[model samples]
Target: MSEKNREGKRSARERLAVEREKRKAADKRRRALIVGASIVCVLALATVVGVLAANAGKSGKSSASGPATAPSGAVGKDGLAIPVGQDTAKSTLTVWEDFRCPACQAFETAYRPTIRQLADAGQLKVEYHLVTLIDANLRGSGSLRAANAAACAQDVGRFGDYHDVLYQNQPKETQDTFADNDKLIELAGEVDGLNTPTFEKCVKDGTHDSWVQKSNAAFQSGGFSGTPTVLLDGKNIYADQTITPAKLKQMVEAANKS
Candidate 1:
């Protein structure tokens, strides 16, 4: 071959090699940018999720700690339960409830009449322990606030009346209506003398929040499964689907005779 032809061919080969290397470098740079952008998007999404979680946790109030001051005449383990009916009654019914829990509300609506009759007759006594299960599970403070307000009512010897009133007017489970102090105070009008300044102060100040938190902690630690845990003389009668209001009354009457 001619020397000139050979030189031209070699130059052409060198140019092709250089063009290929440039394209490879450009492709590598584009891939690096794409990876960096993906990492940034992931990080931003994580931050957004973190912010939402924090906001949900901050609604209305926070989990309480330190010493717990219970309502007046509270009894039972750690003084967490609010007692109803005569202490001298023959049968003791223990109830664990959360105001924002739909099952608890249903239980109260179905059994309250019979329970009240039994209590008034001095045959049965009921002890109520309030917890904040809904607040923790649903991410709101209505359960905590309502429990605190109930404790406040207990302070003035009006707990039973106010407790019934609360259940009668309970809001939807998903609604955080009870979280507002003004709303709680407004509802006190349903119970005579429950709207007093002392009760109002107690409700607004969250006087029994720590106590409510303590009670909820106990409920969670005790391994019991859900709200409205009604126990009649140490038996979880609420879990027994066969039990009815009349049956409960009959059981209490039998216990009174025993």
Candidate 2:
């Protein structure tokens, strides 16, 4: 072969060799990058899982931390559904209460948090039915007025807040007289976004008087001899001696599993 042709052939072979080496190096770098990225992804996922496990353990040790329950079935005549949680498909609880009853007030204070938690969790539902069984004075015009006021609050989409505030600001049973029209307006004012004029008109006109009667009818049919009778998913929640938060929570938890 000629010297010039041989030199050209050698140059071509050297170039091919260099190109192969460069290709091999690039492949190695890409593989390394892929391997490194996979490792980082795995580590990140493991770290997230570990954090979740730790948080769950800590929550299990605490009293306040737990799974939320549903409360979808708690439909009230006052347009107050369970405010804190979603409701389950089959689980429904009902609360029959008399506004002036002290035991009802106690239940309101005690079981409210658990109810809110479970309701927010979407595991349980709570319905409220007003019973006029506190005193003779509360039965006639007084009970009707209060019950209608609550209904009017419901009309304005402030029933839940109004219900809570009413129980929170309940007067001593010995005070004899319950909330008058002025007091009802004042209590209604405590709830945000409640139209005072409309509520006042409803209360004055007894807009929810029929609702009060229906509640009474339900109270009678449900066999609630008194106020603050709680039914869990249809069955009555027994409060033998004292109605407590723990007991109420237990009731809801039991219902949740079933």
TM-score winner: 1
State in Å the error of residue 235, model 2. 1.8
Error of 2 at 4 (Å): 99
Candidate 1 is scored at a TM of 0.76
lDDT of each: 0.77, 0.55
**Clashing pairs for predicted structure model 1, backbone only:** none
**Per-model TM values vs. the true structure:** 0.76, 0.61
Q: On residues 1-258, what C-alpha lDDT tens digit does candidate 1 reach at each position?
A: 999999999999999999999999886764344222222111111112112113222223433543588899999999999999999999999998888776676677767899999999999999999987766666677888888889999999988988887888888877888878778888999898889988888887777888888887787677777777779988988767557788999999988887
Model 1's C-alpha root-mean-square deviation from the true structure amounts to 22.0
- Please tell me which predicted candidate would have the highest lDDT against the true structure: 1
Q: In angstroms, give how far residue 161 of model 1 lies from its true place.
A: 1.4
* lDDT tens digits, residue span 29-138, model 2: 64344222222111111112112112211101211123311122336543333332354434667776666666666666656787787777777766677645543322
- Error in Å for residue 249 of model 1: 0.7
Q: Over 4 Å off in model 1, which ranges?
A: 1-63
